[model samples]
Target: MTTQEFWNKVKSPEYKVTQPRLAFADVLVQNQDVMLSAESLYEKTKTIFPKTNLSTIYRNLESLERLNMIYKVTTDDGLNLYKLKCASNEHHHHIICTKCGKVLDIHFCPFDTFSELAGKAGFTITEHRLELYGLCEDCRK
Candidate 1:
C-alpha cells in the first residue's frame, strides 16, 4: 500500500496517528516487498524517528495487525515477521524467501481441496493459513 493509503486506513477514532506510529507505518509501506522481524522494524523506524522505542513499535504493530493493515507470520525459528498488507482486496496467501525475506503474494488458494477432504472426514475447517518458504531466484544464486 502507498503511504497515503496507509494513513487513510489508520485515520480512525480509535487510533491516534503519532509521529512514531507514522514513521513505523512509513517504513512498512516503503518496504512492502520485505518481511521484517519486530526488532528489525524497530531499528528501521528508529532511523526515521529517533525518539521511538521498541515497546511503542510493538504496540503499533499489534494495533495495526488488529486493524488488518498488516500481516504477521512466524518463521520456522520462531521469529515473528511483519509486512504491510498488500493492496489486493482478494483472499490470498504468501510465499516467502527464506534467504532474503522477500514476500510474494500467492493468489491461488488450496482451501477448496482441503475443505472437500475435511467434509468427507466429518470435519469442518474453521481457519487456515498456507505459507511456502524457499529461496527466491536472486537468493538462490
Candidate 2:
C-alpha cells in the first residue's frame, strides 16, 4: 500500500499511530516486499528517526504484529524476519530463502484437506503456520 493508504488505515481508532510507530510503518511500507530482521529494521528506522531506540522498534513491531498489520517468519537459522501483511486478506504461507532471507508468499494452504483426518483422530484444528525454506535463485548461483 502507498504511504497515504497506510496512514488512512493507521488513523483508525484501533491504532495509536505514534511518531515512532508511524516511522516504523513507513519503513515497512517502503520495503513492503522485503522481510527484515528487527536489527535491520531498527537500523533503517534510525535513518528516518535519529533518536529511535532498539527496544522501541521491537515494541512497535510486536504491537503491529498483534494488530495483524504485519506477520513474522522464522528462518531455518532461527532468525525472526517480518514483513507487511498481504494487501488482500487471504490466508497464505511463505517460502523463505535460508541463504538470502528473501520471502515469497504461497497462496495455498496445506491443511485444506486435513479437516477430515483431524476429525477422525478426534482433534479439532484451529489454525496452522507453515514456512518453507531453501535457497533463492540468486543464492543458488
Candidate 3:
C-alpha cells in the first residue's frame, strides 16, 4: 500500500497518528515483499526514530493487526512475522519462501471443499488460514 493509503486507514477516529507509529508503518510499507518479525521491524524502525522502544513496536503491530491493516503468519519455528496487507483485502492465502521470507498471494480458497467434508462430520467452519511454505525459485537456485 502507498503511504497515502496507509495514512487513510490510520485516520480512523480511534487511532491517533504519531511519529513512532508512522515510522513503524513506513518500515512495513518499505519492505512489503518480505514478512518481518517484531524484533526485525523494531530494529528497522529504530533507525528512523531512535527513541522508539520495543514495546511501542509490539503495540503498533497489535493495533494494526486488530484493524486488519497487516497480515500475520507464524513460521515453522513458531516465530510470528508480519507484513502490510495487500491492496485486494479479499479472503486469500499465501505461498511463502521459507528461506528468503518472501510472500505471494494465493487467490484460491479451499473452504468450499473443506466445508463439504466438514458437513459430513456435522461440523461448521468459522474461519481458516492456509499458508504453504517452501523455497521460492530464486532460493532454490
- Per-residue alpha-carbon lDDT of candidate 3 for residues 67-136, written as tens digits (9 for 90 to 100): 8888889876899998998888699888988887899888999789999999899999888889998899
Q: What is the TM-score of each candidate against the true structure?
A: 0.92, 0.84, 0.89
Give per-residue lDDT, candidate 1, residue 97.
91
Residue-level lDDT tens digits of model 2 in 66-129 = 7777878876679888888778789888887776667788989888679879989998999888
Residue 116, model 3: lDDT of: 92
What is candidate 2's TM-score against the reference?
A: 0.84
What is the Cα-based lDDT of residue 75 in candidate 1?
84
Off by over 4 Å in 3: none
The lDDT values for all models are: 0.88, 0.82, 0.87
Return model 3's CA RMSD, one decimal. Answer: 1.6
Those runs of model 2 whose alpha carbons end farther than 4 Å from true positions after fitting are 12-15, 76-78
Candidate numbers, best lDDT first, in rank order: 1, 3, 2
Model 1 Cα lDDT, one tens digit per residue, 1-141: 788888887787667877888888889998898989989999999999999999988988888888888888898799999998888889888899987789888899989988999999999999898899988999988
Cα error, candidate 2, residue 32 (Å): 1.9
